[model samples]
Target chain A: MNHTIDDQVLAIGIPTDLLSTTVESLRAEILPLFDDTALKYSQVGKVHLNLCAVNMIDSAGVNFLVGIIRACQTRKLGITVTVKSRFVHRTLLFLRIDRHVELVVAS
Target chain B: MRVVETHTSPGNILGVDDDGVARLVLDQYLSRSGFRPELATSVMHAQQIIEMRPPGYFDCVITDYQMPEKSGLDLLIWLRSKDPCLASIVIAGAGEKDLVAAALRNGANNYLDKPYRREDLEQAVNKAVETTRHRRELARNEADAAAVGHLQRHLLGGRNLAIPGKVHFSHHPKRTAGGDFLNVHPCPDGALLVLAADVSGHDLKAAFVSAYFQGIVRGMLEKSTPIDEVLSFFNHCLWSDWGDRSAVTLEMPTSLSLCAAVLPPGRGQATLFSAGFPDAQVVLPSGEIRPCGVGGGHPMGWFAEALPERKTVDVPESGWLVLWTDGLEDHARQLAVSPWGLAYTLLRRDESTARRASIGDAIDDILVVAVALGSASFDEGFPILADQYAGDRWREIDAIQNEWRNTLTLAIPALSEERLCEILICLREGMLNALKHGCKGRPECTASLRFQYQSKARNLRAWIDDPGPGHGFDWASHAYVAQRDLLPSHRGLSMMHHFASRIENHRHGASLTLDFHLPEPP
Candidate 1:
């Protein structure tokens, strides 16, 4: 599981490429970042997840991003996932991750 | 003629020779030898004779090494393969040492030379007859052992014992037959009696001891015997005997390791007696595991003075009492850790990513029993019990949703909508598996559900089980991140990981129990 997290707004960008093999590593890489910076979430009341560069995704990707959001809420922080791909949007809806995370469709 | 009374039935001998004269001579010789004889003119005739007779009709067979159509070596190979213990003698021509060797290699128990004297022929027959008698005795013993296993399995058929709180047990035998016995039943005063025993060996002797122990314990519990008295009865039964029938088993020096406890009905105090087995652990309601006792008592049956004494321990009202066999400690060693640590790791499930630890090549029978004491005990709420429901198709899922709502409304309406949704998702995924795998998507089969809420601790536990026989898969290999390479339909477990605190499956996936820690109310 391999992924690069580019944190801006000190934002943690989840892995863009999610091979099932790489998904776990991607999770491993990003979860600690969230854990360390969790205090920032209480200050803002919401955490933003960037899903723009994720060109292709599967059920695992949908659930992984969903889980990251869940992880955020598990820390008592609200999560807002910003996505531009209608594909990503629909995947979120189908997997029901949309119900848990606030989906901010980027223009 | 001296008949061996050891064999009540007449010994049936199969004699094979291509020459009619030799056959008649052998027939007359066997007749006077006090044995019944069946003669075949050739190896081929002997083969037909042996195959046509009722199984075990011929206790011994004698064949001429040199024959037309088929040789004695060929017949010996066939006969020995069908009954490896069949006593057989091959007759070789004079000075035919090589033929005699071949006959022995082909499974002849004895060999006689051609032109053999009556005494020599009788000597070979005597050895063959004795060997046949021994083989039959061994066969009968094996049959008797199988009967004991059958009766034990029949007694333990599809039985599930439900203790006050959440007590689930899963047993995997190293062999189809094993000596492991585990049971938990409430005493007349609401105190519980938990007996987990493992005898010395994996054979019927071991099973008999365990069955004997179960019977004694049952009788004493019926009479409302004290724990010390129960232990005394157990010890006495293992040491001395009550029913003279059990007296027979005590005649043999046998032993077993066990953890026997009488859990107080309301208070968290539990009296435990551990003998030569793993120390029982007390799991804090907070999920922290600590060893119950520093040391253990002696295993039953080695020394008369190795009497067991009572050691009392405190159990958390919301916590658990875990008892396991030595096999689990052995399993821990395979994982390169201490037994208690492995037990903790299993309970905490710290490595959600790795596969569940298994014994691998060093596998042994394992039993782990834990009792969380309380009557429908949780921090703040009782679990809404849902019995078996037909779960064959998707439309039926509506009934599950409705039931969940009813159970939730009746049980825990104060739960946040977000937490309720998470709980519902977990239920859906679990039942989906029960439907697809357990029920085979068949409309008639049913799956059951139970939901326990601990609002004080902000936790929810749901148990889902199905009636179908269980199956195994790679539970640890589930994908966490999504990708094209991800196996299709790799979503349920990942969903569970996201939504629940711990997802533990039992009975090879026929039952799934998940724990969820709810967030502080929004």
Candidate 2:
């Protein structure tokens, strides 16, 4: 398991089983960790968001990712997101938001 | 020094003061000025006296600015807010300069310290009342203007087609609302009634006449009135309405040129009715034109007593009916040719496939040309025939009528073998005439041919309308020579003359209407 946290950045790589439930629960639980730094780092520069975990993003999970992107932009932060799943890339393309974000494929 | 009557009515003025000096100094001044005044103990009593009387009962309000819970400013605000037109003056004993300014801004007609003379109060009351009357008049005029706009929109009916189909229609008024109206409505018998009318004049009066005709036509349609009866009823109603108005006084009589149709359900059949409008045509599938007969009645609403005759013809299937206002006819005539050029332009082919994609597409193409030619407006592309010269005008009318006849002639190929042969024979004669006579002067002179078959009547008509000056064959002289057996080459004319029922020279072209009773459908 790997976990990294900084002033406006969070990267997590948990076990596949833990990732399944954790990703679903993190939308509500993890949002508060960045609440304090949200206003501080919002106007500074681009915010790096990396999630390298056991992968598959459902419709609801995709919606959570979009919500985070919007919150970062409202505070004037550019976002760079990386996902390993082909499903996530397809969803981004389907939603037409892929053009606005940098989507990196995990090797 | 000088005393003025602050209140015109003696009963309205209360002379009570703070020291309980009722009628002491004020009454003496009022008596000297030849004016009587009423007395009140407090502000509450004075308000009660004013309320008991109707508006304008008191000439002025001269009250102390301070009294119990209600101060003079409060009374002034209440009076101005309620009437805004009420004339009043505020008199304050402990007059602070800022407080006096506040009282004036709060709508007190005038503000004065307690030591102020009676003449000052009287002047303020008169000025305030005069300003109020002027403001009220302006509001009344604005209200009247809004009402007129509302009425015009209601009369105009706005731009919305009642039913959607291959045809599109519109009418534009140059004024708030002009006398022109176009209506499309479903009749009780499942037929669609389409009417376009232009009433005399461009003002509200003309619009009223148009609105009246719209109602009458709709009513007649709802009652299942036949096509002819609808025109006749409108004629009768307009005559009755406009005749009485112009009879007693020498005034311009109101009238309308109406073109109306009742399109039956199915592909191409409609019962058309027109009054003093340019001739309408039925374009057959094969591209022959047939002129719809027009009655010799004056336009609707023109005469006190005139009977209109209506002609009915069974429009063949796979044909298009083109109706026009006089504007379109004039435009065609002005160009010194018939609308054949327009029809050809609209129905032009790529030479590879001489096929019309759709009836709707044809109408759209022609309309585009009409607009480009400045013969029509975007909203309603009815050709304006009045602007065209007489000689040029009739040619356009004949051309469009001929084109309509040609469309039917072209459609005959699908009807039956016998009918097809008859149509071909007529077309053959027209083609030969074009090759021989039309192209003689200038070998490059081109002529087009259209053949139509009337299935119901079992008749075939062909039109070889040409742009050339005309054939020098002298049709009448040839008929004479053929009768005398003098000319040898008169054989072709003799053959066409006997073969076709009628070969008529139209204003700018010629049309050949042939009667072919096809042997009977198996």
Candidate 3:
């Protein structure tokens, strides 16, 4: 997964499995560089997750996404997720996660 | 210094004289007496002031006799013709006793002599002030009552229709506050409801309760309450609110006659419940009139526990339904109704204004509503309200479908309940396709539906209109899907076609029409 920042948007490309090891690297490595609470400047409260390469998320991955959404909601942060795969969109719709998360799909 | 508070504003006084000294002296004295006094040098100028002044502004007038052009008696005569109750004090020079007599004849309230004492002028001004204050108070009270009458007219002003339908009605009250009322609401079952009521007596109290009662009925109808329960609830609400039915000699105690009905549109049937009202009559297309129902029940609020019998009447194709209070019948005789009578009343109505109008200014409270059952032009049909909403408006779509079904059932009850449900499911399928395929799976894009039911023709038809490029669906290929074991995702357009007597697809899958045949009423 590639991490990039342009202007105020933090586009974080996600992994396919979204396993513990992948999430661990994000928290320890990628998150610290972006979550700059010590400095005066920081990424705006907006984060966009590109899930074009990711598919077939399990319950664990779903739970992880929900946690991030809840945290963003509390900090008055907005999160946008783009899913390219119809299967992933169907799964999210089945779980009724679309009620809480803003899920964008290619028409 | 004492801060004395006057109970009311100081009275306005118009002082008139050709003599400058007399005018100045009169003005000073009146001013010291706490009056806003204006001076006019001649009778004509004073007359102009009274005519041009805001109505009821001047409280009193003081005039010196023997003015240049006109006398005090002339001004007094003019003021008396306008308002005899206006207070006036006439001033006369020595030996002008003859002129003072003429002033008194012209209705002057008091008189003061030229070179009169300070006490004499003071007493005359005081007495005149007392009478003018009394008159102003009475006039103010009259104005306040007129304002309340205006408010009642405003509250009853919601008689306009959002869209014109086959039904037409007219309501005429003898006073600004009369007890007649009418209401029409669409039911969830595709039926149209009509409510007409009259408070037992005329005037403000009756009119007020009529408006209040109509409001409650509307709230219940919006929740899709049944016609029977709606009437029962109305009766209970009235009885509970006003149970004091003791005799008041010649006065009829506060009670009301109400008739409520659900007419399944295009179904040729009307289910009605009435309280202390006469049987409504139907006016055939050929102008023949017949009674729709036979019985009249207790007046609403006559008893706490009363269930008026529900009567269902089937109207002839294109016939008109007439619901009225006795006032209309009375006006049908010799009573002149207001201007609305010429256009809407049955005897005077034509195709132009299909409603009812009264004849002459009626003393008795009058209200009438005549609904057209058949329109002359059936090809275009009466247009039902067409609305577009987001794809997720399934609840609204279901509501619309249910209303249409109910209308069919009410109009022709012999159709099996199962059959109605089947038709509704088919209709819903077309709508879902428009919302899903035509709108690109977006909840915000609009999908449209139109329903047409012609009870006389015994048919229910609907069209689902969408704004997307055609799905390019082929009806021939999907014709066998209902018979074959199908996947959950595959639409059973075949079942929809089977339920409908005839189905048509058009505009490259952008619009579809389903026609269902209704059974005879049991």
Stretches of candidate 1 exceeding 4 Å from the true structure: A1-107, B1-5, B8-10, B42-54, B70-74, B93-105, B113-115, B153-180, B188-192, B199-206, B239-256, B263-269, B284-287, B300-307, B316-320, B327-522
CA lDDT for candidate 3: 0.66
List residue ranges in candidate 2 displaced over 4 A: A1-107, B1-162, B227-229, B245-250, B266-269, B329-522
Candidate 3 residue-wise lDDT, B78-150, digit = tens: 8887876679999888999988888888889899887887678778877887887677676655555456456
Q: Model 2 over residues B49-145: C-alpha lDDT tens digits? A: 7678776555456566666766777777767765565556666666377777888888766666767565654455345445544444554545554
The better-scoring model by TM-score among 1 and 3 is: 1
Q: TM-score of chain A for candidate 3? A: 0.76
CA lDDT, candidate 2, residue B383: 19
| Tens-digit lDDT track of model 1 for B226-337 | 7667766566666555224434453536677888878876766878877777778765654445677724556776665465555888887776677878776676556543
Question: What TM-scores do the predictions have?
Answer: 0.48, 0.34, 0.45
lDDT for model 1: 0.67
Interface RMSD of each: 10.7, 39.3, 17.0
| lDDT at residue B35 of model 3 (Cα atoms) | 78
Q: Is 1 or 2 the stronger prediction by DockQ?
A: 1
Which prediction has the highest DockQ against the true structure? 1
Query: What is the CAPRI rating of model 3's predicted complex?
Result: incorrect
Q: How well does candidate 3 match the true structure in TM-score terms?
A: 0.45
